[model samples]
Target: MRSVIIATENLGKFREIKTLLADEFDVFHSLRDFEEKVPVDEDSMLYIENAMKKARKVGDRFGMYAIADDSGLEVEALGGRPGVRSSRYGRSDDERIERLLSELEGVPWEKREAVFRAYLAFYLPEKQRCYVFYGELKGIIGFERKGVGGFGFDPVFYVPEWNRYLAEMTLEEKNVLSHRGRAIRAFKDFHNVRFFRNPTVHRL
Candidate 1:
């Protein structure tokens, strides 16, 4: 049975990716699965670069395939102030939302345009090769946080098309409309083509 590591410590992110890739691999793992956890610094300016860094490190440590994702919220009004540092905006999710709202204080709703961007990186340790997939969801910042569904910025991310907050949507609904979901789907499609066509390639 083929096994792959998700290369993340975030429970919410691990759950979402694992749910989407449940049938893709025989065994799944996260950083918490091993005692000697691989340390990866997400210091890259680009999302893909940061994701690749994590995937490569974990894949090397575990001697298997590893998938990692780097995502952030980019606010147009703030000129993407927290694009790469979304996770570090504050100590907790609530604090992050508070900081974001505070930064956008007095900003009109129309100018509160923002987009959630995700980049998933798949790495093969033996081959030292990496593949990247990208996905994005555009929305505006809400006046206040709402719902208790998703983690991170979901509570305040207002989707005009859906006329609701991202946190208001169910898991299935968010999976179909989320940035990370789209990226993982794209990765799955690529894996199907590349691995199936070249069966021996995945054995590495």
Candidate 2:
């Protein structure tokens, strides 16, 4: 694709995706490149559905390849209370974390299993193809914040294998297993297999 746009206003998602695509594309662009933002809501229940919604909206707007992702944490104890509505849970990150912890109050760590999921939808308008990819990270919620890295609930999300919260790991470390990281990598693989076949299409 000559141009690309990420269907999100989130700084975190934008940064992560940009870093992931750095090697694949010499220079990548996102919705931020535009003077006005592309509008889309995460009202869909399924991640892929929401992703596609954003991707199509943005792809049509820019008339270029657009990628959108819908990701969130689903808590088992709460029966997936904050799945797609993760970003809408509260006005601020602190408020959202507090609300989630309050709802998970008195719950044991084992009962607080959660999964961080990401669904990526890439739309190639020229080819009229829409591709979707998914990735997930399994972990539990801790009693309190533990690390100084990551965003959102990363502070409270514990990774048993790593023996720490996601916030504890550096960007490179977290990307090794992060849901968004996995999904972004998958996007690269897709490009290499399908889109990257056109190596003459240089990134701008």
Candidate 3:
């Protein structure tokens, strides 16, 4: 049976990945599913570094293929701040949102442009090599939080084309427009082509 580990403990991200890749694998797991956890230090300055670090660490620890992703919210007004440190921006999601809003206080809508970026790294334990995929979404930072869906900065991410906050969209809708979703989908497509041609690469 083909199985792979998702190198993340975030439930929201896990669910999104699972929803997209469930049919592709025989077994799927997140970091929380493991009894003995592998501690990973995500202190990389780049998103690809962090993602590959997690995938390599977890894949090597368990002797299986692993996929990891790192995503961030970069505000133009803040000079792309909170880029790789989006998760550490605050003690919690609310605090991060508050801090972001506070920093942009009194800033007009035109200057509130922001972008969400995601990088996904896949580790092939047998080959000891990692491949990365990238995706990004452009949007503006709303003055106030809107909607009740999505996790981390989604509420304040205003999609000018859609004219709705990310949080306002359903899972299906969000998946179609999210940065992580785009990256993961590209990763899936790459896997389909690679693994399909080299069937034994992952089955081993």
Candidate 4:
């Protein structure tokens, strides 16, 4: 199978990509699996810019196809604060949750809306082309964290339509609506359709 490198230090993110692309290619991690530790600046204000930077850096370094994702939580009540700084919203995960809850304190449920936004970039060094994909998950911020299944803001992100926090859903269930999962699905489907139309061009 053709190999594809995913540039990310987060194991959970790698696992999600693996699950999404298992049938299409041999997915590997750019840093963890290969012991590569080159740093790429993530100061870009936009998720696509950050994702493209990482993907291009890793793809050029390894001379292989590379994929990277930049995702964060955007809260309407907070004026879209912590959007690109989701990981560093606070000193720690617990602190981040606390801060989120504190920020929404006394805010009406109708106004405590938020969404998870993800941007995925694929770099093909051989083809000299980059493809970008986007996905989003809409939900409201809960007063308190709930469940223990997911990382980041999962516990505090409640999908009112589903009446449950993201952390309360199983991995499979979450993937169906997750920002990362949705992006990967779109990328995979696009590749599949393109390859199907041009059978002469081999693509994993």
Ranking by TM-score: 1, 3, 4, 2
Poorest lDDT segment (10 consecutive residues) of candidate 1: 195-204
lDDT score, residue 6, model 1? 93
TM-score of each: 0.93, 0.90, 0.92, 0.90
Which candidate do you rate higher for TM-score, 1 or 2?
A: 1
Per residue, candidate 4 scores C-alpha lDDT tens digits across 65-140 of 8989899999999999899989888887789999989888899989998989888888888776678778889999
In candidate 2, stretches whose alpha carbon ends up further than 4 angstroms from where it belongs are 192-204
lDDT of each: 0.87, 0.81, 0.87, 0.83
Runs in model 3 lying further than 4 Å from the true structure: 192-204
True lDDT of residue 75, candidate 2: 95
Tens digit of per-residue lDDT, candidate 3, span 9-59:
889899888887877788999999989979999988888888888998999
> 38 in model 4: Cα distance from truth in Å?
1.3
| C-alpha lDDT of residue 17 in model 2 | 84
